[model samples]
Target: MAMFVHLTSAANAPRIRRSGIRAVGHGQGGARGVYCFPVLPSYTHTHQWLRELARFGSRGGLVAVHMRLDDTQEVLVGRYSDRARGAQSIVSASEAVRRIAALEDPRGWEVFVPRAIRPREVHRVRTAPQVAGWRYLPDAHGVRPCTCDGCRVRGGYGSRRLRERLPHPLDGPPPPVKVLLARVEAGDPGDPVALREALHWFGMRRRGPLSRLSRLAHHPDPGVREALVWAVGRWSTPGVAELLDGLAGDPDPDVREAVEVVRDPE
Candidate 1:
């Protein structure tokens, strides 16, 4: 889970350090382990440095490569559990090198290039609002949102199924009709009812055929007209392109915006 790198300006320090290296490990309770490296004079060659580390043994401890991704570096742990039997093929540093080098291959995950690690630092902070529109849920969903506090609360499940329904477009099947029927029936030309209906239909039978409802794109109501643009965007029907293109120049700004949203989601 942790990686440590040593850097020194001396050209021959690594070579001198590598000559008398030893593999050490813990004994019983909370004992320490140490391992030395056979370094070479100035790792001017990358492959040589990698080979030296590959040959260095770790006795029976874990071996891993610390990889760097965008803003984080990952420690990929190797699997090596046995030590007492001297099972030569069970684990080796060469295996770790092969895994680490594989990371650089295009077919494999990319390797971590060397970079400086920033020092750990701390800063003060404060809390802020967690989510948007949670306070207005009762008004939005036409039902009370959960208001139970942690203290003195009771919980129970209701077996009853609350089947609230909403209106469907005249060209299609009925949907879960809602109390907003009155508003939808009498709302202005820019009302969002038709868009809401299309969204409902889109959510319900997404796999159903669309050839029959294609005519709804020419509905007299701008809301219905705009909804058709959005529906075509959602369904991605090639036949509705002409209708959406016409609505792109609708006099109503809302309808025009809907047209644009459908035409260019970017």
Candidate 2:
């Protein structure tokens, strides 16, 4: 019993006048009903619709308008129009989504507003004081006493400065994959090195060589899948688009919602 109407130019003004009156009666008759009206694609058209709706005085009516914006930044507003009443303008789509998640209705509708796009300008800044000259520490052996807390704790002033040889080539233990997985999952913003390493290992190109490891991205474990989604957004790799497209159809709504966030224009 729900009805949807698309409005555009002033040329359709007469048609809206006829339809708006009918929608109120129609909505009141149905147990649960919606009257969706999408506007044509132009800012001028959208503005006109708002003006007309206000003029019609359909303030308490159940009629809703839809606004469409094109890539060129044109806005189109559509609605059922009745001279007897004006329609309420709903909240924007982004706000509506949040309200919906909170189990609340965002009863009004507004047109999409395109934000101004500007190019980023990079300016170099000095590195943090903590690691500013850290590279020189390894070669400070004998030349300077080790002031490191570790050296003091062990009661050995410069023991850490003494260079140690690498373990025998074949004697070193391989890295623990589970630990690596856990580190990636943690995704602590404080640890850029760990984040980068995890991204490299699980990413499409590098992961291609590690087929079994990459399969963990689509693992049955919710934690693993969630981490994979986060990694994909963090990395923002080219192939990630295809992966997200696939996830858009996932049976799990959470996964689909995550994918939608990355795909959204805003």
Candidate 3:
């Protein structure tokens, strides 16, 4: 058997003790599953989700519901954003533990069992530290934080303070695709940071003029070319293939690597 821990609100303790943790969706468009982490040898690593989970405003208190599952039980495992990016993979319970343990930094990794966990499988429900893990993201300290609405919750903990402390180029709602494209088309493309932000926003939103974006393949700045690769990958329209093929052999290794990561899975 493999040990795992599910962090939840202490308010649900009674029902969880009686009927077990229910399989339900969390977050917008989240998959229905019981999220947990493999109870590794390191106590801190096992309970790394405590602080981040508490940010959701749990009532009563927070607790860690330790549970056990057979090594053969299958589950979904990947980075925290893998599900949203359509990149999560399936593996056995033991394999999931081994895979995460092998990572140098498994802070954002998670496992999802698709069904309900019976009360029998729950080892114990114990009080957990309210502050044990990274909030917002793992190791976010020292990095320039994004203040975009999508990235920062309007009233989330310390969100306003962080935005005031670190203003980013991509800090507000992004301009429309045409507006961004116009900025790139200007003879003097100002602010490389803003330019890159525009391209990345295009990629994320999956909009804009595909033909015009394709022309950026030969942009002078490698960073622009890399951002172009991001935008181009989001487009599945005509002419995108030719642009990607050209970018696959970019002189800069980073641009080529971006092409690999952004390319649609086969």
lDDT leader: 3
- Residue-level lDDT of model 3, residues 1-266, one tens digit each, is 98899988887788788888877534224555689999988788888888777654567778899999999999888898887876878899999999999988888889989788999999999998786888768988888667764566545778667776765566544567778888777665455677777787676453457776666677778998898887667565777778888899999987987777555221
List runs of model 3 lying over 4 Å from the truth.
26-30, 148-266
Error of 2 at 256 (Å): 0.4
lDDT of 2 by residue, 1-266 (tens): 11123222343334344442111122221211223322223333222233323222232322223322222332212122221143423344344333323432212333322232111111111111111111222234456433322122222333334312322233222235676667655632324465445543443221222333344445555444544565464343446666666667767766665565444311
Residue 62 C-alpha lDDT in model 2: 20
Residue 49 error, candidate 2, Å: 29
Sorting all predicted structures by TM-score, with the top scorer first, yields: 3, 1, 2
Clashes of each: 8, 17, 0
What's the lDDT for residue 92 in model 2?
A: 49
Q: Rate the local accuracy (lDDT) of all candidates.
A: 0.34, 0.35, 0.77
lDDT of 3 at 231: 69
TM-score of every prediction relative to native: 0.27, 0.25, 0.58
C-alpha displacement of 121 in model 3, angstroms? 1.2
Q: Which stretches of candidate 1 lie over 4 Å from their true place?
A: 1-199, 203-209
Q: What range of 10 consecutive residues in model 1 has the weakest lDDT sum?
A: 121-130
At residue 228, give the lDDT of candidate 1: 56
lDDT by residue for model 1 over 1-266, one digit each (tens)?
Answer: 22222211123233323331111222122122222111122222111222223222122221221211222332222211212232212123333334534443212111111222222310111121112112212133566323221111112122011111222234223343342233344434434555466444552322333454545555566667665556555454555666667777877777887766544321
